[model samples]
Target: MRYTLRQIEYFIATAETGSITLASERVNISQPSISTAIAHLEQELDTQLFVRRHAQGLTLTPAGKALLVEAKRLVEHAQQLYEVASEANDKIRGQLTLGCMVTLAPMIMPELSHAFTSAFPSTKVMQVVGDHDTLLQKLASAEIDVAITYDLHVPEGFDFVPLASLPPHVLVGEIHPFARLSAVTVKDIASEPLLLLDLPISREYFLAIFMQEGLTPHIAARSPHQDILRTMVANGYGYTLANVRPRSDTAMDGRKVVRVRLAGDHRPMVIGLVSPKERRKSRLIELFENHCRNRISDAYIPGMVAPVMEKRIRLD
Candidate 1:
């Protein structure tokens, strides 16, 4: 025996209204047609679906209650299918999933959130934060619509759009001797204890800077959380080298920590927008990416923009 979607819709309508006359009016069919459809459905399932009496309307039997649950679900799924099809034919209004690297999440997310929400009020935006490799995997699997991250050794199936360059700077404890200086040379940092950011790509970049200067940093502590390294530096634990500056104004407590320019030609970090190469461009993603590019360009300063020509190796 086979049941049809129209039969399920009639079943749900009758269950909701409790009167064959009202259900018929709601479904825009004759009352006898509604009754016949319900009778046919009950016969197909070999169960009594309704208990009827004179002028008392109808009540569901135990079997009727169970069938009603499945009937409602089927109707809902059918409606959802229609809604999805209609939305696909129209503009972007569904949910959009995005991912970003941990460091970039703090610095650029606020602006992106405000702009995207204001422009596309109906669209729902969901964000996931992870390291570069993890986000890359998600983007490739279509789990995320796009990713914003540092321009590292990107995988082959991804296309990158250069957004901005965050030059490397030295963060020193406010109480540290060098904090009083406006800027310090490689010789000064090379002799001091260094707190490393410990992220694979960032660590490699910093180590390369020292190698280029013909010196080795005295390593003290390593951390993945930038805030932890900042707090440690605030207490004069040690200094760290970072490319992205903190967007917040606290500066790790208004005192006890400061950022100073690092000497020598350390390669600047290239930050950019990343997305899967094969995926069709989404309007929402394009809007957000354009906002990022505009914000970065407006904030650009001569000698501060890191060139994208830096070479990197894929660690994964």
Candidate 2:
């Protein structure tokens, strides 16, 4: 039973996208090629890997699930080997795939990209934006080198380092009553219609605000797209809860959205850099990680902000 690394790569891609067509598009290969590779992999392993449906996408069988863990390990080992060989030649020229949440991507990526590029001109960086779960899956599979996101449930066998602490702020349409308030409290927000950022960790974090106040919020809508949520709040559809405050210059266009500090003791969101603990680090990954850490430390002053909530909020 000889399964090639290319087969594993295609399988992981299909697993991530859930559609052979989409996966092929992502990897820039033909759908028939991907399908053939998957079929060949199943034959070599002597198990049916995926259960296909007519309308829906494929789901991994038990055999597929078991093989995924080994596949990721194999891929990571191969990546580490490639990195070592590249460094042996005294060149840092290679791909650096990074994962980030939608919120942080817009604010921090510009500076990060510029600084990293200036320092390591040879390395090519690729950014993938997704929620926590999606990013973690990619990280585990060696598809992405690192992840930048809010510190949520840190899985076993992963290392995390804090980057910045963001304080929770209230976002309201200009016409909303709370927009006139100097500062608002969790209790005050309980009765208002709220548009929650529906990212995995964010949904839990925002809803936990209500739990802390011992009340359930009047949730208006939940979505993963930041733009959609922002537009919803800006158009007077509902208010939103966010840790990162909107920059004053970009706060409002014609939509008339205003950001206000939350009253009382609030939970600070700690965004961090995460990578697999068991995997051996390359010089490139180490250099990029250190640069990010230094930039974050210089940007955020700890005494100015409180610590994040220690309790984990379960959305599921």
Clashing pairs in 1: 174-256
Q: What is the Å distance of residue 88 in model 1 from its true position? A: 8.5
| Per-residue accuracy of model 2 over 77-126 as CA lDDT, tens digit each | 78677688778887665557788877778767777867788877877677
Error of 2 at 285 (Å): 1.2
Clashes of each: 1, 0
- Per-candidate alpha-carbon RMSD to the true structure: 14.8, 7.0
Instruction: Evaluate residue 302 in candidate 2 and report its C-alpha lDDT on the 0 to 100 scale.
Output: 25
TM-score of each: 0.65, 0.74
**Model 1 regions lying over 4 Å from their true place:** 1-91, 247-255, 298-316
lDDT score of residue 232 within candidate 2: 82
Model 1's lDDT to the true fold? 0.74
Best by lDDT: 2
* Candidate 2 global TM-score: 0.74
Q: What lDDT would each prediction earn against the true structure? A: 0.74, 0.78
Could you give candidate 1's per-residue lDDT for residues 225-316 as a string of tens digits?
88788888887888998876663424555555677778667667777778988877655566667766776642551222222322111111
